[model samples]
Target: MTITTLNGVTLAYDDIAPPGGAQRTVLLLHGFASNRAEGWKRTGWYTAFERRGTRVIALDQRGHGESVKSHDPADYGRQNLAADALALLDHLGVGRCDVFGYSMGTRTAMQLALDAPDRVSNLVLGGVGGKLFDPPRPGAAEAMAQAMGTDDPETIENDFLKSFRHFADEQGEDRKALAASSAAVSPPLDRAALGRLPMPVLVVAGARDDLAGDPAELAAVFPYGKGKSLPGCDHFSAIPHGALKAAVLDFLDGIPDEDDFPPFE
Candidate 1:
């Protein structure tokens, strides 16, 4: 574990390379309520990447892992999260690289790619789908915030919110910090901006993931985007599924360096 201060927030991250050295790098952004270890390392991602001579850089986005926790809703905006990731890359002296994100991580990755396209080569989004384009459901954030803040779990009637609460408890997360982040409002995704991205993108999600909606519809919005559906998987199960890793590795293996192709017209 390494520590760096970006935007006045202390961030925790890991930088792992193969024995001989890394031929490439991939930044991993995990889902909300999950840290780098639980989301990537334990999921066999680190080992998989190491075998391929790819360096792995993963961060516990503020408030989730060993990183500094902030109970300020004003501090957890999606752009702010994305900025931290961008700053981490700059701090590491890494140039362009591939990016993979899951659920909330996908939001941050998309923001980073939009804000600094040249810094990202290939993009992989998992555990999310067409819901990416939808407006925030009214009161959903508030409900989640309430669920996290409440002392009694029984009060969380919504199964989705309850699941979040249960997961947070299991992870031993700071409920106050989670409450703040859950209540924060992120800027809506801009379809026009996404359509303009030139890098290859893969959107993968479980076919039963209602929270993500249809992966194909979301992929259609990108210039060079494709979608993959995992059978018998849902939002949670999809994260650790071997198929998810296989799909990501396959997609990444097929992409050449930026210099190998002409600018998209």
Candidate 2:
């Protein structure tokens, strides 16, 4: 793990290469309250992409993992975090690469693509669905923050927050930091803005994942985006499943081709 200052905040990241090196790389961003390890390494995504001859780089977003933890809500937002991704790429002298994000990471990845369209060749967003296009409302983060702020997980009323409380406990995350992270002021993205993304994109979600919104509906917003659902999986269990891996690999391999697109009138 290497640490660097991005916009005056310390960020921890990992830049791992494949066996014979790779002509391309994928920058990965994990979901909220989660770090690179749980989202990528622990889920076997690191090995999956590496095996396909692509390098992997994952960052512990500001308040999560080993990155700088701040108690201020202003420090964590979509734009602020997106800048961190750009700084990391610049630090490594990377011009352009594929971006892969899961859950909350998908938002950050979207901002990255929008902010620096030239720096992104394509995007792979997982654990997300149609809800992204909807207005941002009070999400589970605040509830989860309060839930984790307390040591007793049994008191957590929300099933989603309860699962995260378990994960935070298992990973020994700093509860205070996570709580602050959850409280951070993150604004929702404009649905119309996504139409400006000038690259191909893939959105994957589990069939049973209500948290992901509607994958088919979400994919329809992007000019070249496609949606795929992993049958019989949910929000938490979707990424680590084999279906996600297969979907990602096939997309990168360009299996569908232009012929696969619905004919234009």
Candidate 3:
């Protein structure tokens, strides 16, 4: 575990070097309220990437894991988070590499690619799509915030929010910090940036992911993007699916055969 102070916030990250003769390097951005260890390590994503001969760098986003916590919404934003990712890459002397971001991390990864396409060789987005900018699911964010702030469990009051609350409790996270994290970085994105992006992009979503919006709509916006759906999975369930791994690994290897792609909607 290494820490870097970015504009007064301490961000924790891990860098794993591939054994002898690495093929490529990948930067991982985990989903909201989820840290690197839980999102990538415990989930077997870290080992999977390494097995593909790629060095891995995973970071605990500010307000999560060992990174600094902030109760102020002003402390977070899409561009700000994207800048943090770039600064980390700069700190590590990483010029070009592949980037994989899931759920909330997907927003940061897309911004990173748009902000500095030269720094990224390939971009992989999971568990997100065209609905990225849609406002939080009614009271979902509030439910999450409430969950993090309370130990009483009954205070969360919303059944859908239980998992998030449970997850925060299990991770021993700061409620206010995560609450702000969920509310911040949430202004609509610069949609124009997608068409202007220079690298090939891959958007993967679960077939049953209502929260992810339309993956096909997202891919259509990118000049060089493709969307794929994993059958029989929802947003969370989509992560560990073998089909998801196969699809992503295939994309990382090279452009997929046209047949594997979703028609632009």
Candidate 4:
């Protein structure tokens, strides 16, 4: 539950270590509107990774959870979001770490790897797409802003409930904030930009995801990226899907021996 103050924001994150194991840390960035607890711990991912001997650091991105909120739409831009992540790493005194992001967080994590390639050792991106774009829904921006502006228990819980069962649900208050975050400005990445990455990358998606394009099409964007689509699952539920999770862990373990970076201490 410790909070780190960095770049004018209080990043609430959970740093979890194994029973008595490695220092290598995997930074977990949750999707939009959702907080760190729901994205990682509540979903059973935190325990899964910890059991694997990899320390996990799950972050509540700015404007969500206990983090600072910026009224300026531009400040919520993807670049700034990515910068916030790097700043958190610096604040933690972590030289390098593995990263795993889902949906909105996947985009942010990808931008971080691109912005600071040397600082990233490995990446596992789930519920991802080839390009960064706003989800298909009306009044998306307004819904997201409302979520950021308030921390009402009922409102927040409602938002999470709405997003459940879909890989990329884009409705309700939290969904609206996510849509707003994506719609506020230009996308952080362009087509073909993902393929140029020299690092090992894993691209994941659900077979039933409506928000993102085809999994094969999305995976085609990354040279080293491999796609795994989970059948009978949608955007939100895909993360918890057995097939999806295994695909991610397998990809992370498949990184070339020499290029692998140690987890954070």
- TM-score order of candidates, top first: 1, 2, 3, 4
Tens digit per residue, CA lDDT, model 2, 29-85 = 998778999889989998898888889999999788999988776788889889999
Better of 2 and 4 by TM-score: 2
What residue runs in model 4 are displaced by over 4 Å at the alpha carbon? 130-183, 255-265
Q: Please count the clashing residue pairs in each candidate, in the order shown.
A: 0, 2, 0, 13
Model 1 scores a C-alpha lDDT of 0.91
Measured with C-alpha atoms, the lDDT of residue 122 in candidate 3 is 87
True-vs-predicted CA distance for residue 79, candidate 1, Å:
0.9
Name the 10 consecutive residues with the lowest summed lDDT in model 4: 164-173
Residues 1-265 of candidate 4 have per-residue lDDT tens digits of 8887877767788777898986578899887667787778877888878778988887788666666655456667777778889988887778888899888788788889888988888887788664344454575555544544444434554444344413223223244444345447746376566678777777768777766656666666777666666778888788767777677776777633322457668
When sorted by lDDT, best at the front, the candidate numbers are 1, 2, 3, 4
Off by over 4 Å in 3: 135-140, 255-258, 261-265
Question: Which candidate number would show the highest lDDT if scored against the true structure?
Answer: 1
Query: Which scores better on lDDT, 2 or 3?
Result: 2
Backbone clash total for model 4 is 13
Clashing pairs in 2: 129-212, 130-214
What are the runs in model 1 whose C-alpha is more than 4 Å off? 255-265
Give the per-residue lDDT of model 1 (tens digit) for 158-226: 998899899989889899999898888777889999999999999999999999988878988999988
Superposed Cα deviation of residue 130, candidate 3 (Å): 2.8
TM-score of each: 0.94, 0.93, 0.91, 0.78
Better of 1 and 2 by lDDT: 1
lDDT of 2 at 44: 97
